[model samples]
Target: MKTTCKSLLLYVLIASVAVNAFDPFTATFVVGVGAALGRWIYEYSQEKCDSKWIAFNATGLETDLERRLFGQHIASRIILKAVTGFMKNDNPKKPLVLSLHGWTGTGKNFVSQMIAENIYKEGMESSFVHVFTSELHFPHPSQLETYKTQLQQWVKGNVTNCAQSMFIFDEMDKMHPGLIDSIKPYLDYYDKLDGVSYRKAIFIFLSNAGGESITQTALDFWSAGRDREEIELRDLEVALSLSVFNNKKSGLWHTSLIDKNLVDFFVPFLPLEHKHVVLCALAEMEAKGLQRNLDVADRVARDLVYFPKPERVFSVKGCKTIDSKLDYYT
Candidate 1:
């Protein structure tokens, strides 16, 4: 009877040990599943956050410009927010510099990633200078009218009682001629025309408009009814005799038909000193191998730093234009 009882006790102990041994395997399986699920959730959350940030920050950038210029930079959205803050503020007057990129480039290319990165590092809410770019495609006549109306509404809504704003229109040559007329209302009112002190806005129109048709138009403006041959000859002479920074060379005089009643056209040529600074900046960028093309290097450099010494003179013998400067830098 005693022996039988002891055997039974041993059997029960063995069964208990076997049950305990399986607990570790069960626990390990549960832990593995939990870890995997946690990792997947964290990754998904991060991706969602990044997408939201990008969309929130790039509110006003033209889609094409954003895709082409800021596609690589991670901090573009941040820089844009800083710029928007500056635009909204009314205190401590600062010029609103608008950069218009030429054909085949986005504003981001002209502004450069380095510059945008630097702007982001400065932190948001700090009052930095403001710069904007109208990199959207040239609008049709109807589109231009629509844009004008929308812009007017925006100003009325956001900039109440504001006295002045600076405006820059880049690639003016690419825009429909009628669009130019649509903007006249803004310019005229800002300049305090008709004895009213509305706003003080300085308008800058930058374009490559010295082509045959443009030149002929200038000739026609001066003297109508001339043969195409005579107009072409006069246009050629006018184009050649005009100073490098002259309106004729820069194609700013085309605004006469659009806004003749407004202030006399003011097309300040970028100074030679500024040109040299641009060249030096490009050279520095090239030394760093940021870009291979001289034009690209110069543009990137300008985006990084404005002409530090606007008064420092540089010769124009070989660096006659921005294009020439780009060639030398390259």
Candidate 2:
């Protein structure tokens, strides 16, 4: 509006200088052009601002994240609740930060993808969704300083540009502790932070750091003749946090995030049972548009390796390889 008004005034001045008096017709034409330009500018600015509001599909996310993630009832439920609250909170003071801890192939990554797919119209391909794997992006220990700088800048730049941005850091167990701490600022609560508010952003960290402790807790419950369903978030919360903080291999060890309690949730993906594996196999078959067969699913489940020779408790790889293992039955 300012630019257009200035240009219009300049045009009238030039016209008046050229012809002792400004032509009313020329002045009217310039004013009309300025009005059009001002409207265009207003529209452009609105579009830019509206681009930050993501089309979050809460209902679809509930179905996909819950259905796809098996053998993790407690974790899935907590995730759904946290996400629902996060989305509904109009003016959040901190980013929604989640630390997913569990065994490999136990649906940590799968759940993350489900969240991304449902929240983003472009699914996993959305530019607003950023994924970083330690193996792929932070492979060198010597580059920890550089990685920290880049990570902070990347997050600040994205969140500043789009408050609804989402970031996923995979294989977080391999990321440096220093690097992990770099994200603490964004997760901390402040009325106004760094001249930019990150209250609407989302950050997810995936790792196997607490898998052993989680599995053991589950196993203890099973041995005590308790139903697997009895295991709850309250049961694992303290253990999971301690494991992540005390384990030397975990990137979060001794981090201020734990002390400040910045992590919104510690969701643990429990080990998958045979029934969960069967469900996974069935889902995979359905994805291929193949008819479901209980016999095939049963065989695939039996063939999967389980731990503790006698008990034969949990699937070694959970449902991680269930899709590929289904081919053997064919």
Candidate 3:
């Protein structure tokens, strides 16, 4: 009844203006256009939390991670299980918090991108997927207090808007220590803070904080003549977390997030070997819609610097410069 009366009043108002503003045909056209514009604005501004916008394809994520992401089998597996399990749950106790630690170009950012692409229809372009770079977003140390307040509000407001929202913090190694603690409340086991449940949200922290420890473990395996793929999460998680906590340079220096067991996983992205770099080059070519050129890919991979003096087992920067390097080679 209320809806019908509203429609009648709206129609009457339009009819009232039909004479002075426009002819009958013109008035109808104007009203139609106005309605369409209003609807378009609403659709454009609001992102729906329906299946159309948010759907997790676990198989797709696993397959892509296996195909597109090279090396670091442990990181890939942990990501798949942790994310898949969390999304599958109807009611989670706390937000899924993952701290991805690795050296540059070893696929920390790449893995994060893959996760977003699988969950959100718009991928990295989705409004619900928020990315904050420590250096770019919160550079000034003197503003630690201000950054904390703003950071808390940002997470709270975004999660309120969409519970399944993904927040990625890039370059966490450079982030001020206490700044992250501001949002610690959101990562806790609480059902809700201020009547808003953050349990469904996702928080990812990327950093080079524990790269040394991870690399050392991989190097040790190589020294023992074991396959790099044989390296497991059990081999690295403990040392990695400890190193990240102790390292003064790492943004997570003695953070309560780790102390209180808030971070669910300290995923270690191992250094990329020569073969992995070659795979990266080939994948880049495929992504660019180019024909698979093994020779070009080989050259591109070989051109990069590798480590450990004579052995040169791992690519120093992994696939970090693969895209531009491919452009130069091809």
Candidate No. with top lDDT: 3
Instruction: Estimate candidate 3's alpha-carbon lDDT, on a 0 to 1 scale.
Output: 0.89
Clash count per candidate = 1, 0, 0
Q: Write the per-residue lDDT of candidate 3 for residues 1-330, one digit (tens) a residue.
A: 346546655765565566457877877776776567556555654558778889999999999998999997898889999999999999999999999999999999999999999999889989999999987899899999999999999999999989999999999889988788899999999988999999999999999989989999999999999998898888997888678988877888877887899989889999999889999999999999999898999999999999897999988999999999999999
lDDT of 2 by residue, 170-289 (tens): 988887776888878888997557798888989998999999989999999989999889998888888887889988778788889889998899898899888988899988888878
Candidate 3: stretches off by over 4 Å: 1-46
Candidate numbers, best TM-score first, in rank order: 3, 2, 1
Global lDDT of each candidate = 0.38, 0.83, 0.89
Better of 2 and 3 by TM-score: 3
TM-score of each model, in listed order: 0.33, 0.82, 0.89
Candidate 1 local accuracy as lDDT? 0.38
**Model 1, range 174-207, lDDT digits (tens) per residue?**
5554454444555443433343333433344445
The pairs that clash in candidate 1 are 294-330
Q: Is candidate 2 or candidate 3 better by lDDT?
A: 3
RMSD, every candidate, angstroms? 19.3, 9.4, 6.2
Question: Which residue runs of candidate 1 sit more than 4 Å off their true CA positions?
Answer: 1-142, 155-161, 189-197, 211-278, 281-330
